[model samples]
Target: MKDTATPRFRFIDHTSDLGVVLYGKNLEELFQNAALTMLTIMLGDIPELTGEPATINISVSGTDLSDLMVCWLGEILFLSEAEGIAPCTIEIKSVSPTLLEAELRTVSVDPSSIIREIKAVTYHEIKVEKRDDHWEAKVVFDV
Candidate 1:
């Protein structure tokens, strides 16, 4: 089992949409890191929730790891776009190949602070794989 305490991911340049190449020690970490990446891209930094942090629970379903990744990030995108909520921390409690359950620690962001408006998470050029000892995924978002 990999350490669930810290997850990792990085952003990549994309011609049309936002892109990220994520790394994790395992599948659960991959999902958690992907959520962080999505939030960072939206806020243009690692978000810090001020005042009282709001907690929101999220559950997303997919048919496989790839699909689940898209769905997981897509759910976060939806919250930002439709609800004006941005997450500072994402605690993924349970994750499987087809399902994810998480608690999002968030803060309400002013509409203007949404530096990058991501319209949707896409499957274009999406791939999840294991390389050497870690899992990596390439995700693209429609802007």
Candidate 2:
């Protein structure tokens, strides 16, 4: 979402849920883009950095890369719905298969503007892989 331009993330056909295939060049970019994509799905579009931005330092650990991906996006969902903070910019300083550290530029948003309610970042069909030139992740959200 930050590095891969044309299609940051694309929708996948799902009968009963919402899905996206996220793209990036590395694990850090992949996680950063994943957070951006999750925010877009929640807010319909990425909201501009409007006012004074707040920096949020986030660190999450997982059992593996897949679980790390899930935890990464799940934290975004938690921030949006529970904290009333919309992510504007994501800067992941460190990322590994088991640990991720990031800084998010966020702003306060009107909760009513949130059109879609993503209940959770589901594990169904979730994937994170390194391709020949890029990294990709398949994520489905429970709506």
Model 2 pairs in collision:
none
Worst 10 residues of 1 by lDDT: 1-10
User: What is the Cα-based lDDT of residue 66 in candidate 1?
Assistant: 92
Model 1 pairs in collision: none
Candidate 2 global TM-score: 0.94
lDDT per residue as tens, model 2, 1-143: 34434577899999999999988888888888888888888898887988799999999999999999999889988888988987899899999899999988999878898999999999999899988888999999999
Task: Return the top candidate by lDDT.
Answer: 2
Local distance difference test, each candidate: 0.83, 0.88
TM-score of each: 0.87, 0.94
RMSD of each: 2.8, 1.8
